[model samples]
Target: MTHPICRACGTQYAEPRDDCPVCLDERQYVAPGGQRWTSLKELQAEGHSGRFEEQGPDVFGIGVTPEFSIGQRALLLRTPAGNVLWDCVPYLDDEMVRRVEELGGIDHIAISHPHFYSVMVEWAHAFDAPVHLHEADREWVGRPDPALQFWSGRTKPLTDELTLINPGVHFPGSTVLHSSAGDGALFTGDVVNVGPDPRWVSIMYSFPNHVPEQPQKVRAAADLLAGYRFERIYGAWWGRVVTSGGEEVLARSVERYLRFERGE
Candidate 1:
């Protein structure tokens, strides 16, 4: 709990440092007010509590009430195989642990990118679950731990019904999960961001800096996902979800993005 966590990115470092590399990266920004630091113990004392809401059938969106750090919500995907956590938040306590355990607990954890890797080791320890992260982004990991398991390649099947696919977009190892729930669903954590229009989605190299993703990379993501069957797309936020036509939405989104990028 005392480990120094970046206030801008919510990344908990193994040791204290004057700066957070994740924030300083072009993909993210150091807070305008300047870099600040906090710890889980401090957040608990500040009365930051967990917020849980059903984003889909059994997918619960979890985050801190005061929206700490990047303010992205992690998803508790209760798949038929087992309960897998899609991402992680910075704040966690006994209550959050107890609450999650009551919901069948977490069997595995998979993060989309480095920005959302906040206190993941904490969550993994709480539930005795292993974390699956892409190896390409290993250098960005704030705190290395045995609980973190790295995989390299385009896809790794977690269960009979779920698979992790790297789109190679926002981050070199940016991952998205496909679940055979209902018509199927893709759990993306800002890797393939669900846009304001639920029917559409977007990809970016640096969302904070408005940097466009490479046209080839975006096209490759869509091509890779074209093989899956999904109706819903679950984004990384509280309400950012595409309820239906997940496959078509992704295809169209990439086509439009490429066309626009080419000034067609």
Candidate 2:
């Protein structure tokens, strides 16, 4: 049986449900027309195909054409260790799998937050890789699977050069992957949102509701990330990458956010 995928958020549940908990949350919203559901097979039949683009050096952006659900593209990080899939989309097919396999199949899968948790299990099964998620947001997972592995802590090391840091900005378990490739790059799936300007990043409790994250929380996140040196910030969507000065961009963004929060 096909799992029910949310038409709004793209999260696939183990079975059919009346509502999508992800969309019902404050960070997201249920469609004005109300909740609708679809399956991966249905999406494939509807002509939805894979979209792949080079986001940066050694970083390939993977997304869906015609933009399904949240429309956040996943990044295939090609490190010397292997390819790492940062974040996930709701749709996947045999062709997409074959293309990735040709480029060196995925070694591991990591998601930045709950919003990007769309059909992660499906992807894991396809690649036969482990899905690393923060234990804090375990409740939000729509589909429980044996392949899903939960980690607890402020940070977890995936490789000598790659580490998963939980800044706890957008969600309690919200994460960002710091890669020591080239100069360095931070893979943030809307956890540290890359602004439209491409040079600025922002922190938000809920983008859909226009809610600002707490100043202290933002400050703490920035402080924790200050240790790393990243020249680029990769956001969730296509073309939302900060090509250079990622570390400075994050520092300035936090200062700006806190300054405004203090009403200064």
Candidate 3:
């Protein structure tokens, strides 16, 4: 049986489904006219191509090979300790593995939420690495593949050098990773998204569909992150990182959330 892929997020599902289960929630949706599905062999036969864009010395944005209408991207943070694949995609193959290996084999895979848990097991096996998922979001795990090593607790160190932060934003277990990117930097998956304004940082209750959030949760998450001094925030997608004054922008974002939550 052939499955359909959600054009909204590029996630494939078995059989013909009404709507993307991942998007059916408040955060995402299918394109107006629906989507197209292609098998691995079929896609490869067409000579489809995808590539990664270098964002910084050790950061990259991985997008669709042909560049879909919606350029959804994920981050690949490389550090001396190891590499962290943040927010994954549904499509992965040997070619992708080879490319990643050329840059440096991945050591850890962490996602912001379950929706991004696409082909995670396949990814883990490719690099012989363990997936670091927050304990609070265990139920949301889409695959629950045996390869996943679920970890409970506020934070977990991948290799004594890398750290994962769960501020509880988009999801109860929605997390961000804070690793030393040379000089001084923090890789915030989506807990603190870089707004359209490069200088401003943003957050929402739901990001897939642009739904805003209540102030309480925003404030709490912000408070949780106040302890860190990050000069830059590496967001989930392309052009979503603030290079300077990131801490101040984070505090301001929290203030905005407080006002919205309290209706002030």
Question: For every model in order, what is the number of clashing pairs?
Answer: 0, 0, 4
Which residue runs of candidate 2 sit more than 4 Å off their true CA positions?
Answer: none
- The local distance difference test score of each candidate is 0.92, 0.93, 0.70
Clashes of 1: 0
User: Tens digits of per-residue lDDT for model 3 on 148-255?
Assistant: 777776787775556787887777888887765454566765667787786777777777668876567777778877776677787766777787777787888778
RMSD of each: 0.9, 0.7, 2.8
TM-score of candidate 1 relative to the true fold = 0.98
Question: Distance (Å) between predicted and true CA of 211, model 2?
Answer: 0.6
lDDT of 2 by residue, 105-222 (tens): 8999999999999999999999999999999999999999999999999999999889999998899999999998679989998989998997689999998889999888898999
Compared with the true structure, model 3 gives a TM-score of 0.86
The runs of at least 3 residues in candidate 3 whose Cα sits more than 4 Å from the true structure, single-residue gaps closed, are 1-5, 12-19, 34-38, 181-183, 260-264
Model 3 error, position 158 (Å):
1.7
> What is candidate 1's lDDT per residue for 102-132, written digit by digit as tens?
8889999999999999999999999999999
Report the number of backbone clashes for model 2. Answer: 0
**Could you tell me which 10 consecutive residues in candidate 3 have the lowest summed lDDT?**
35-44
